[model samples]
Target: MDSNDGFDAATKMETPLKEYFDASTWARIHASLQGSLTKRGAGNEGTRQFLDLVLLKAESGIPWSDLPLSHSKIHNVYVRFCRWTDDGVWPPVLEAMSEAPEAQRLLEQLVRNHMIFRRSRKFRSEILKAS
Candidate 1:
């Protein structure tokens, strides 16, 4: 069997989130998230990398540990994500970005996938504990 096993080339070639949005659209989304990012003390490039890592995770349905090393540390990104969720920063940012249809669709998919992944992980942990 090939080293890639069950994975397809497209999975390996996953594009960065920034490429999906034009410069103007990205600027809008970035602007929308700027306050939260700044409050977290994340610089522009770091914030972009963090967002890209998140989108990649959502799209790939991969475990946090499986995230590429080239991106920010997985633990840091995951913690930031949880903090954003707890602080309710995502909804308003997502709402603001929804003005762009493509961005809206992609963000919706990311949200849905992330939710499903979280539920499944919780269920699996519960099953393990029960067993």
Candidate 2:
């Protein structure tokens, strides 16, 4: 599949897929991610674009290296994915987006199956600060 397989400007400019997330949901995710991850560099691809690419990757269940250049560099996407996973950045975002019953069920399954982490001191501190 092309890197931009499911996420192109034309597609985004039109209606977004409600099954995944809407534009406002993406905006919240992007803002939260940026605020939480300070070292995130401002890539040419904006947070929305990056998120679109990530969603595409997740939905397609493809290897990170398979991401197309039209999205972002595979290396960058992989690095961000790792960082986000390690930093416990995704659970909250998923929780916030789980408004629909389907989304909530999916989030529940994901957490039930794969959500396990020992909180680092730094991670705890960040959570406290956010509170």
Candidate 3:
């Protein structure tokens, strides 16, 4: 059993099994998620990448070997799959795109919609006016 092969790097460098989050399909999903989605353990882009792969598995079907180490590793996994159900550290860029002009229109058309609000409306308006 040579651990120094390339197995470690193979899964490490490669992205998730599915393509749930991409520019072409972000608006619909994000809005469906209610403006933004924060998975339980999802943190940074890597976690989101992993979750997207998990998502693909749920939608289509995944080969056991393709799952992450947490789901694949027979010994012990550093991160688990279910831990990140909905937290808040996923992708802001993708969320922002859901609110973009084009995407916003599409999102409104769909049942799900992104509700944008400002904590301080007056201040925000002033800032916008200044800019």
Highest TM-score, which number?
A: 1
Clashing pairs in 3: 38-86, 38-87, 38-88, 39-86, 39-87, 40-84, 40-85, 40-86, 40-87, 41-84
Candidate 3 per-residue lDDT, tens place, 54-122, comes to 444444444435555444451222233322222332244335545345433432322121113223565
Better of 1 and 2 by lDDT: 1
By TM-score, the better pick of 2 and 3 is 2
Tell me how candidate 1 scores on lDDT. 0.68
User: Residue-wise lDDT of candidate 2 within 63-110, one digit each (tens)?
Assistant: 556555533466676666656666777776666565534554554444
Better of 1 and 3 by lDDT: 1
Q: After superposition, how far is residue 128 of candidate 2 from its true place, in Å?
A: 37
Least well predicted 10-residue stretch by lDDT in candidate 1: 9-18
Rank candidates, TM-score, best first.
Answer: 1, 2, 3
Worst 10 residues of 2 by lDDT: 10-19
Best by lDDT: 1
- Per-model lDDT: 0.68, 0.56, 0.41
Give me the runs in candidate 2 sitting further than 4 Å from their true place.
1-20, 41-45, 70-72, 100-131
TM-score of 2: 0.52
Q: Which ten residues in a row are the worst by lDDT in model 3? A: 109-118
Q: How well is each residue in 1-131 modelled by candidate 1, as lDDT tens digits?
A: 68757655433433444444566766777777767767676455776677677767766678777776523466788888877765767776677665566556665777666668778999999999999
